[model samples]
Every structure is written in structure tokens, then in C-alpha cells.
Target: MTFENAVLKLVSGQINRVSQPATLRTEEKAVAGEAASQTPFSEEALFEYHLYTLENPATLKNNQAKQISLMSADSVPIEKKLIYDSSRNEINSIFHQFQSV
Candidate 1:
């Protein structure tokens, strides 16, 4: 192969890093389909999410995280100004940190 062809193959290979899919039994198919919706999250986030689940679990699990975030947005109540204050404080802290350096 020419140098260009070899370099092209190497770059293409790096783009496809996902592993092969697992072959599952018929019974496992249902469970895998049901569980596939869960996203990668920190352990703390998972624990907190499950804690909420214990009180009231979502009817459907096979959906994106946005579904859950939206569910929380509808269910959980908070003062908008309070949220704004915390966000402002965070931005100000970042700004000060940069200014100091």
C-alpha cells in the first residue's frame, strides 16, 4: 500500500472505537431492551436518581436523560430567583478566579 492509503486507514480506525455488540439469549433481549435507556452518570448521581425512584418510579425506563430532566422540571419546585442567585454566584466566582490570576 502507498503511504497515503496506510495513513487514511489508521485515521479511519481511530474513529470507530466502539466495541462489538453482545449476543444475548431471548430472555436477555427483554431485559437489555428495558435497561438500554440508562445513561452513564456519576455514582452519586445514580444514587440520588435511585433515591427519587424509590419514592416514585417513572413508568417508562427506555428513554433519554432529557425525559427525566424534564420530568423533574415539572415535578420539582424551586424559586426561580434562588436558582438565578446561585448561578450568578458561580459565574462571579469564575470571573474573580480569572481576574486574580
Candidate 2:
């Protein structure tokens, strides 16, 4: 199988002819503290999700791992967020946010 310039979030697999969820590897980088510096008074902020696309067709093999390069941009905008989830033991989580353009 091969994919070219595809934004695939979920992929399917077959196990004993039964359809199942397939695993995919992804790499992402975001710059934090950029948005926080702009809006310090906001309690919650929205950020963009980075979309990665292949420059060429990537071939996939069964039970074999392959590394491919996605799109690379210089100085991509990002936001840093601190989330407090009450449902998950009241522990705070820090994550970089990205919005898809």
C-alpha cells in the first residue's frame, strides 16, 4: 500500500478477516509560550493542529517499520496551554496546541 499527500488520522487493519484499528506513527513539533505571551488574561485558549503531508508516495509493508518525512516549515506558530481536568484525579496537564490551517 502507498499514500501520497494524505492526512490520515485513523487507518483500518484486518485480523482473521475482521476489520480492526491499525497503528500509525506520527511526529510533531510545536513552539510553546508564543500564544501565552500574547494573551495572558485568557483562562482557556485555542491553538492549531499541525497537519503532516508526504512530499512523495510512501510505501507500507506488513510487519515492517519505515520512517518517512512529512512537511517541514520554518517557525510554525504554536500555543502553550495548561489544562486542569477534574475528572482525571484533578491533575494538571501541559500540552502544546496547534490549529490546522
lDDT scores of the candidates, listed in order: 0.30, 0.44
Q: Which lDDT value does model 2 have at 21?
A: 52
TM-scores of the models, in the given order? Answer: 0.18, 0.25
- Give the winner by TM-score: 2
lDDT tens digits, residues 1-101, model 2?
Answer: 54444433322233364665554223331222443334323232224333233334445655557754322444556789878887886749888765533
Model 1: per-residue Cα lDDT over 1-101, one tens digit each = 11221111001122344797567766445444444434222122332232122222334324323233312112222233322356555533221111100
Q: Candidate 2 at 59: error in angstroms?
A: 9.9
Query: TM-score of predicted model 2?
Result: 0.25
Q: Candidate 1's C-alpha lDDT? A: 0.30
Q: List residue ranges in candidate 2 displaced over 4 A.
A: 1-63, 86-95, 98-101
